[model samples]
Target: MREISLDRLRTLVAIADCGSFADAARALHLAPPTISLHIADLEERFGAPLLSRKRGQVRPSAVGETLVKYARRLLAEAEQALQDVKRQVEGKGGRVRLGASTGAIANLLPRALELLALHHPGIDLQIAVLTSQETLARLKSGALDVGLVALPQQATDGLTIKRWRRDPVMAFMPAGWKCPARVTPQWLAVRPLILNDSSTRFSRLTAEWFASGGQHPVPRIQLNFTDAIRSLVAAGYGAALLPQEAVAPVQDPRIAMRPLRPALWRELGIAHSAEDIDRPTQHVLDALWSLRLR
Candidate 1:
């Protein structure tokens, strides 16, 4: 005998649930004859009667009762599988894995992610904080769907990068220091600077900006976390250069920011794989586009 088909089992279970073949056919959107044929096929496979009828109503036999339980579970599993596929296709209820630089995370990226949660409740998001180089590497390897990276000066071959926002690089200094309205690279070089180590792209960009102006201020402190940087700045450890948005959430009375003259800026962008833009990736890109910074 041929293996029992899931479709035949489904028809049997549906008829049992509806208590009639005609009703089951209607519920399944199948013709009544087709429904009958499915049940007949099931009986043939089992070599025994599966369903009984009396008073124009259909009921399951003893063996059919046991099969009914298994059939229900099988149908449920099949339906769930389809729903999972649909969720992925619709981008409504799947996981979106993303990576971003620490600077972007300190900026308004959290707000954008919050907006996505509010608007698209079904999508699950996983975000990782990585440097721009790490983010680019993971994106290239298909480890991430979307990446928030500092705009690279050079061209990237296999990725699509678009500017999400431009933020001024500002000097976070101690309040009451009476600095200029806009700090120049020359003016900044005179003060002790708390520089993030030159391992990150942002740090390299900052280092180059100072180097081009023939300024190499001695570093008083070296740290990575933005909040820690702000805290150290507020405590008057040393002045630090950071993106404006990174300082937006700071309300410390002791900390003040002065925009750099010649207006040094960091261009933050969203990068994605060029070959296949998955639904989840597109969903995140759409959210990023709607951000106030963008």
Candidate 2:
């Protein structure tokens, strides 16, 4: 017996479905001769005619009807198998390790992760809360797959960085404090400040903002975490310059958020190891890109 051919079976089913050899060739993008050859080869192999043809019309012979039924199921299964392979290879079902700062984890990552879970449930998303410096170090050592960090990380050879978003730095003060729609650095300098710790980029930027105005204000309290700083500001302890992400979520009635005069902004970015931007990491990036964050 001649070996069975899926191509011939598919072509036979196509001819039966379309009701003519010429139509089958058009549908399958095959030359008419190629379609004729496929039917002939199948008939020769099975030792039975597969088509019943008359002027201006075509139908499958009894034998062709049986073959076509099996062909449809077989082709569908084959398509499904191919899709399964592609999904696995593209990291749709794999684990993605992600790192980001506390502010990102609290304000930004939750929404992105929720979207990822809704669409790609098979991907295991593992997240770690780390400082920008810690995230970069972990990325270099292959301990992390991807990171959301402040822009301009240490120049290194093995990392690919892309700008993600810029969060405006807003000034947070106690309620009933008189301030303009946009507070100036000179105005901020006179208020008792509660700043992010010196290790954080926010601290450096806030310091630079004041120095540019030929002023500097010592903090009444210095802390690394945004929520704690917000707590102090809400309790009437001091004012703070915090990213909009950190200030937007506070529910305390004592807190008021205002833009900076020059509109200071903190740039966030995505970084991955140049050597290991595998499929799962890219899926996470794709999910993040789908979000429109302010």
Candidate 3:
């Protein structure tokens, strides 16, 4: 069987809606003969007269009513598909897969998400908490669209890593402890320390900072989650070094945040495939960039 053309379906729908062939032709900017031919073709295909004249106004025959009902749904679905494609092209709707650390997602990404909601509410971000290395690997393997990862990462092919933000690594300790104006490697080394896992890039970076001051001390415990580490610090388990977002207003009285004396920093980068970036991903990137520190 031959497939029906969209033009005929559109004409039929318009005529049914307008209640007259002439009105439908005028509404569709088509000739009267074209409208008549559309109904004739539809009736011929289904072997039934589709429209009838009743009380000087046009109406659908019983068979025509059934076909028109189906036609309306099919046309509505087609229109919805067209609109969805247009929204994607306009950067107004689609899913953008992204990866970031728990710290970034907690303290940093909320502002970016707010901006995204205000501007591109139609775009959904699928977030995964992942390490810098895992995020980079997923990006290269085409599993993710964007990534927020620790800085100084080794270069990977087919990926572009843009500098995103730099946050100072601050000492988080129990508020009741005797504190110094600035925590140093020597001061922190002697205390029980909670730090990121040895497998993490930030752990290695912090280790290097300690090594700079001739202090190579093991942490009391190691874990990757930043919030949990902060909790341990509040309980006086030890002082942990972690990044503080400059704009974050800390009001927790259980723990105090102090700057590091040697000026250690936790840097982050945005990674993506070095290809023509799609609009949805680009919008997310723009939102992330809005949180850049200086």
Tens-place lDDT digits, model 1, residues 172-207: 999968899988888888888898877877788788
List pairs with backbone clashes in candidate 2.
none
**lDDT score of residue 233 within candidate 3:** 86
Give candidate 2 misplaced runs (Cα > 4 Å). 1-90, 245-252, 292-294
Given candidate 3, what's the lDDT at residue 210? Answer: 95
Model 3 TM-score, 2 decimals: 0.77
Per-model TM against the reference: 0.74, 0.65, 0.77
lDDT of each: 0.83, 0.84, 0.89
CA deviation > 4 Å runs, candidate 3? 1-5, 36-67, 84-95, 117-124, 141-143, 180-190, 210-222, 261-263
For model 3, the run of ten residues with the poorest summed lDDT: 243-252
Question: Which is better, 2 or 3, measured by lDDT?
Answer: 3
Model 2: lDDT equals: 0.84
Pairs that collide, model 1: none
Please give me the total number of clashing residue pairs in predicted model 3.
0
| Tens-place lDDT digits, model 2, residues 1-294 | 857888888898899899999999999999999999999999888899989988888899999899999999998898888876687677777777899887777678877888888988878889998888898889889888889888766677798887887888889999879978889988889889998888887688889888888888888888877778878898899999878864245467888888887778888888888774667678888888765455
Best by lDDT: 3
Give candidate 1 misplaced runs (Cα > 4 Å): 1-5, 8-74, 292-294
Winner by TM-score:
3
TM-score of 1: 0.74
